[model samples]
Target: GGPRTQLEYRYVGYAPQTVEVGNRTMIDVSLEQETNELESVVVVGYGEQKKATLTGAVATIDMQDIKTPSPNLSNSLQGKIAGVISVQSSGEPGYDNSTFTIRGIGSFVNTSSNAPLIIVDGVQREDVNSFNTGIFNNIDPEDISSISLLKDASATAVYGAKGANGVLIITTKRGVTGQPRLTIKVESGVTNFTKTPELLNGVDYMTLYNEARRNAGQSETYSPRDILLTRSGLDPYMYPNVDWIDEVYKSFSSVTNAHLNVTGGSEKVRYYVSASFYDQEGQYKVKKMNGYNPNLSYRRYDFR
Candidate 1:
């Protein structure tokens, strides 16, 4: 026989005990428990549903697999999702928005409308075609909690006209009923050309050209001695055995990203705030007359 007090804690473990005393009672408690997978909620066209009950063709992206440093979410989604094809057309600093397709090309009549609709926090955004660069640059990757892609018609039918291509639902992180927590993440890396074309040098070019001329029943413009001089690396100014690929392209470029996030609150009201900074230096090297070399670079700061 004893007095007992019961308390409820969310996402936490607890131990209960009973105590008894003459006319007065007190219960000492200790906590130790682990939480496991709960039901997952997914957002669809106009409402939300449990992932287990959803009948549409949907795929959830695992944020853990997106380890590459990218300026936009599109770049990180490359090859990470099923039936999605992402192509980065250009490596230009801020303009590096990747072109992505859901399933496959739907129609050739209107190539411009092939892009999927982007919905952030249940609001439809403007078509990305209107923006010259990646419209998602303002979004910090750390702030994203989950990304749900709706592919089939039954899944995207709610949008009516805009549902022809598909739909991409982006969900941001929200504070939970817990102690205030702060997280800081920093990443830095380098980018370089994976492969470059192998072009013929000046001597090889001259030899090939002379061979072609001889095949056409014409005299060889470059003599064997001339070819030897070009191959021997003598008087480059005159022979001009230039490797244009090396002259134009750089070996590598640098990239850096940093993010800070704070989240916490009570069950009634929660808050999440984040700030991020990203910088990427392009591989293009421009030579200036005054002994200066400038490389294309991009810097962006984001707050949410």
Candidate 2:
């Protein structure tokens, strides 16, 4: 047996356990907690129940379910969640969030129609009608932990009249019991016009116009010499052959997204914090005046 007075066992937030004069082979010790602390628990508007036992029509999705490069969280929800009808009115960077509905439109009133109640961390967010940033929709997708869609009345009874349309609950990531963990994610890509209208330059336009005139039994409007001059690009002022699309558009625009996060905590204090950035360049090629170019871009930064 070893001496009992020379050893001490200490654990943070818990009372120390001392093994005094043990058998030297095996010992059992239970360390009591010095302080009580709150732990993580799942709580819906009402109470939580197993999926098999759930009575209301509620849908849930985890981070893996709606993961995408899109900064707009709503954009990634389309086609991924059941009973969710997601529609995007525009593809513009900041305006790309989908205007979604749960179980389709429930009201015919224009102002209140089709808009589901958005709740983040148990607080209701304002209903948004415009393309501007939606409080819940603009949340960093990586910062989100889970989302729930309360489709039927039974599941959303607690929300009362506000839940007439439906309810969407978003919960952000929080700290867990572990050592501090750092994570970094980066994404970069380009976007190009999928399709564009075919247009004719000066020479082709004149040739086609002259052919049409000839088919109508009329004289040629543009002389062959003028057409040749336009094709030769000799005098842009008098016979300009300009392709506006080639002038207005570039090959592609850039899109970038990044996220960095750290999560760590002791049993009594757990925390999750993250920062993210999203930037999208416009497709239009703007001309520079002097040395400065007025380029178009959309940028969003999020910290949680």
Candidate 3:
């Protein structure tokens, strides 16, 4: 029954009512962003350290940002942080070890161990590859509580010898000091490859073969005219085009992962145990190859 303005302003206080009128009048409303002092904490070695005390540059990859579809853990980190380069290198199953480097190329030699030192929990591992690729590749990247990369010499000095290249510290899930907590994670999807290469047809392949023989001064090795007549007009099945890459690659792949975690405890005895199951079949049969560490000897073809 009253003015339209009164109806809109009836439920709100003066501040909100003013904001509504400003919008109706096309006036810009600006306010300073407020930050919480209690929320500003830097992640140090074991726990959160105040951000103000941090001396060296440390970048962290937290859980919420990582809880997405990432087939390779290394691929998840690509271009997400400054000064960190993660390369998938190869997609072969067991060998899908991602190589990481900080800043740029710091070593003179290409084959030199240019990988950053990887530390898990409180222990330092010789190589990130020391663990099975299957273990790290399939697990939820979100399971990682935090991944802190230490780049400067000041940050690298603590571990000494192994820290020469750089340092990467990884923290896994831990118990919280509250009521028993449960986390159920589930992901289902399909993956496939595209843009494959083409192969030569029977006629073209024979033409190339004949030309090679003629150039090698073996004119009689291939009867070009007869070869063309025999293959040119035949069904494709009679002269099958074998696309090796396609023959070895699979057209369809799917994965399903589910995990359940339980944790909660007092200061003295805290415990965490999680069991996960992962099954992945590749386009290639020898998807994962763990070759001989060191070959004892090489035998001739039938000499064994």
Candidate 3 C-alpha lDDT tens digits along 18-115: 33342254445444332333235655544566545667767766556666655555656666668866666665544655656666766533233776
lDDT score at residue 140, model 3, on the 0-100 scale = 51
Against the true structure, candidate 3 reaches a TM-score of 0.65
Estimated TM-score for each candidate: 0.75, 0.80, 0.65
lDDT of 2 by residue, 275-294 (tens): 98889998889876998766
- The order by descending lDDT is 2, 1, 3
Predict model 1's lDDT versus the native: 0.76
User: Which lDDT values do the candidates have, in the order given?
Assistant: 0.76, 0.77, 0.58
Where model 2 places Cα greater than 4 Å from the true spot, the runs are 1-43, 105-112, 288-294
**225-252 per-residue lDDT for model 1 (tens digits):** 8999898887788777888888877888
How do these models rank on TM-score, best leading?
2, 1, 3
